[model samples]
Target: MVSTIDSPEYTEDTFISRLLTKVPTPAGEGFAPGDDAAIIELEGVRFLGCADGLIEGVHFDLGTCSPADAGWKSLAVNLSDIAAMGGTPTSALVVLEARLGEADGESAAQAAYEGLGECARSFGVVISGGDVVSADRLALSVTVLGELPAVGEALLRSGARPGDLVCVTGRLGEAAMALATAIPSGTDHPWAERLHRPVPRLEEGRAIAAAGGSAAIDISDGLLLDLSRLCCASGVGARLDTAAVPRPAAAEWQGSGAQRVAPEQLEKAALGGGDDYELCFTIREPLLTRLDELWPEYGADYCVIGEIFEGSGIEGPDGRLDPAGWDHVASGRRSLE
Candidate 1:
C-alpha cells in the first residue's frame, strides 16, 4: 500500500490520507488521528496526547524569532492541542536537533532551553527526558501529555451537531499582521508579540468542556481550515457570518508594511492565516446562554460567528471558502525558489 502512493506532487493531505488508510483504528476509541489529540481511557482515567514540530525555516526565521521565542512556540503549539481537548497538560518530551557548528549555536541552544523551561514552569508542566542530536539546522519536536478533569469530558471534534453555534476566542488576524509587518526587535509591536508569543486558551477550553461544548479545535491552522475540519469530523456544515468574525484592530497594523496590505486583504489573511493558537469551538444551542454566563470566568472573550447545520462543507456570507491553510509540503515547494 505504501508503494501505491505514487504521486510526485503529493500534498500533506495526500500523505495523511494514505497513512490513515494503512493504520488500524483502535477499537472503541472515540477519538483518533483526525482530532487535535488522541484521547484514551486507561483504568477509568482519560488522557490526551499530542505532538507538534517546529522546523528552522518552515516555522520560524532565525532573523525574526529569538531562540527563546522559538522554544516557547514549539511547546505552546503542543499545549494548544491539549487545550483544544479540554485537558490539563502535565508533562512533555522535547526532541531537539541543534546545529553545532554555527557561531551562535551554543548561546542560541541555551536560550532555547531557557525559554522552554520558563514556558514549562508557567504552565506547571514538567519536562520529562528527551533525546538530542546534531543537525545542520535547528528543529524541535514536542509531545505533551495531559489529563482531563474528573468531572469534565474531553472535547472531541466529532461532537458538534446541527443547531450548534460556532464560536472563537480572542481576536483574529493579529498574528497575520505580525507576519506581514515583520517588525524589527525592540519596536514594541503588539502584532509581533502576538505572533511570537501565542497564548493557549486552556482555561477557556476547560470551561467550554465543563459547560457542554459540542466540539472544539485550536486555531493553529487558519480559522476557516480548522473550523472546516471540526465540521467534517462531526459530519455537519458551518455557516459563517463574515461580518461577525472578530478581527484585529487597525492600529495593530500600523507601519511601513501596513500600506502594502489592503483592508480587504487583511480580512483574507485573518480568515486563512495560521498560528493564531486561539480556540474555535461549537456549543449546542441549549448551552449558548450558559457559555455566555461563564465566559467572564475564562479570562477571554468569545464571539458566536456562525452556526452548524446538516450539510457537507463550510459556507460564508460571500459563499464557499476554500479550506486551505499553511501546508508544509506545498509551502516547502514554493520556498525552493
Candidate 2:
C-alpha cells in the first residue's frame, strides 16, 4: 500500500526532507545533508566533499554546446560547491556515461575528457579514479574533494546573523540571457562564454572566508532562491535593494552581436536566472572595512546587494520577493523562465 508521504505531488524540498528522516546522519559525522557540502574530520584536519551531475537534455543541448564545454561545466559546478565552503579543491572523480555506438560518440567523449583535463590543470586539481559506462545519451557526474586546516575555518550557511551585509561576486544574468537567445556554441556572443565555460570563484571564496565572512553560498540557482536558502539555514530574514544588484551591462547584450535585452528583462534575469557560478556571502558590519581592503587583492568584482534581519523570509523594495529559481522537479513539470 502506498503511504500519503509517497505521493507524487511532493515538491523536491519535501521529498528531500522525508528521505533524510529515513536515513539519519551517522552518529559521529561532522556535518549533515542540508548544506552545500558534507564536512568531515580526520586526524584533526577537516575536509569537504560534494557531488554534482549534468545531463545532456537538462543541463545542455548537445547541438548547441560542445562536448568540451559539457566536460568543463561538469567539474566546474562541483568546484563551485567546494568554493562555497571556502575550501581549495584538491581532487575529483568523474563518472562518464557515453553513447558509444553513435557516429560522433567516441570523438565527443574524447573531447569531453580533454576539457576536463584542461579544467583540472587550471585549478591544480588531481583527476582521481572513476567509472565509465555506455548509455543512450551523454551524462557526467563529478565528485570533488577539498580541505580546510581548522574546524571553524570552513564557512557555513548557518553562520549568517541579523545586521550582516549580503554580497555577491561578479555580474549576474549573462548565463540566463545566453540560454534565452539560444546562441550557438562557437558564436562571439558576449554571454556565450558565461553559459558554456563559467569560472568558479575559488580565490574569491577564500578571500571572503579570510576576511571573516559570516556565511557563503554559490549561486548555482537563482540569486533570490539561493539567498532564501541561506537565510533559512541561519534562521533569519533579508531585505534586498533591487537597484543595487549587479546586472550585466546593456551594451553587453545589445547591438548586432546578440539579441538586445531590455533593462527590465535583465533585472528579472539577474534576480531569477540560474547557472552563474558566483559566490554570495554575508559579512558582519564591523568587518566591512577589512573586506574592502582584501577584496581587491584577489581581483574579484563584488557588490553589497542586501542585508540580513530578524524575520522569516526575503523582502525586496516591493515586499516579499517570490522564492522562484531553477527547481529540478518543478522545472521538469513546467517552465520557470
Candidate 3:
C-alpha cells in the first residue's frame, strides 16, 4: 500500500513533526540529520552522513542548465558537505522526482542518472540505492555516507582558533557571474564552469585533514556568509583582505576576456554569490606553512584570505563585514544587479 502523509494539517511546522514520526527510530540510534553530517559508530569507526535536495526553480533552471550538469550538481553539493566535515564519501542514495509532459522525462531522468553515475565513479562512491516518483517538476535529492579514517579525526566549523589562517581552495566570484549573465550556447568559460559544473575537492579535504585543518567549510553560500558561519560557530571573528581573494585572469579578464567579469563587480560575486563549492578552512600557522611547501600537489588555488580573531563576528576587506552578503530567504534574482 502506498503511504500518504496524513494526520494533522500539513503546515511547515507540523510537516516536520509528522515526517519524523513516520520514520521508526531504532533503540540507541547513534546519529541523525540536522547537523553538518550525521555520525554513526559502526565496526569501531565513525561514519559521516549528509543529504541535500535540489528543486526545479530553486536549485536549477531547466531552460539553461543541462540535465547532466543538473545531475552532477545534485550529487556534487552533497559531496561538498561531506568535504566540509573532512570526510571521504563512500556511498550514496539518489531520489528523483519527474514531471509528466516534460519532453521525454525518462530521457532526462536517464541523463540525470548518467551524470550522477559519472561523478560517483570518478569519486569512487557507490550508488547503493535510490527511489523515483512523479512530481510537478524535476527534483533530485542525494544522501551521502562517508567514513573518517580515525575517531575524532573529522574537521568541523567549531574548531577554528584565534590566530589561525583562513584559506580557500580555488578562486571565487566566477560562479555568481555565470548565474547573472547568460552564457551563449556552444560557449565556454572557466568561470562558467565554476558555476555550472563544480569539482568537489575530496582529495584536498584529505590533504587538509592530513595537514591538520582545525576547522573547515565548503564555499557553497559565498565566502563572506560562510566564513561568518565559521566564526559564529567557533565563537571567533575574522579579518579578510579584499585584494588577496583570487580572481580569474584579473588583468586580462577586466574587459571582454574569457571570464568576462569586471574587476569592480568581482568583490560582490566573491562575497555574496553562492555555489562555489571550494573548501574554506582554518589551519594553524605552522600547518599553513607546510601547505605552502606542498601546495603544488593539490593543484587548486589556495590563498590565505583572512585570519581568525578572538571574538564573535566577522569582518571583510577594510575591516567590516559586508551587510549585503547573500541571504537565502531574503536575497534572490530580484536583489542582484
Candidate that scores best on TM-score: 2
lDDT of 2 by residue, 51-86 (tens): 999988889878999999899999999888888888
lDDT of 1 by residue, 1-337 (tens): 3433345346566678777989886567675577888876679766888998888887888898888888888898888998898888999999998877776876777788888888898888999979888887778899999987444578889999989899999888778767766764335777777788777888888888888898999987688878888987899999999888887777556553355556665676678777888899999878877777655464568888999999978888878977666666555421100
For each candidate in turn, the TM-score is 0.90, 0.92, 0.84
What C-alpha lDDT do the candidate models reach, one value each? 0.80, 0.82, 0.74
lDDT score at residue 309, model 1, on the 0-100 scale? 90
Q: Give the TM-score ranking, best first.
A: 2, 1, 3
For candidate 2, the TM-score is 0.92
1 or 3, greater by TM-score = 1
Q: On lDDT, who's better, 1 or 2?
A: 2
Candidate 2, 277: how far from true, in Å? 0.7
Clashing pairs in 2: none
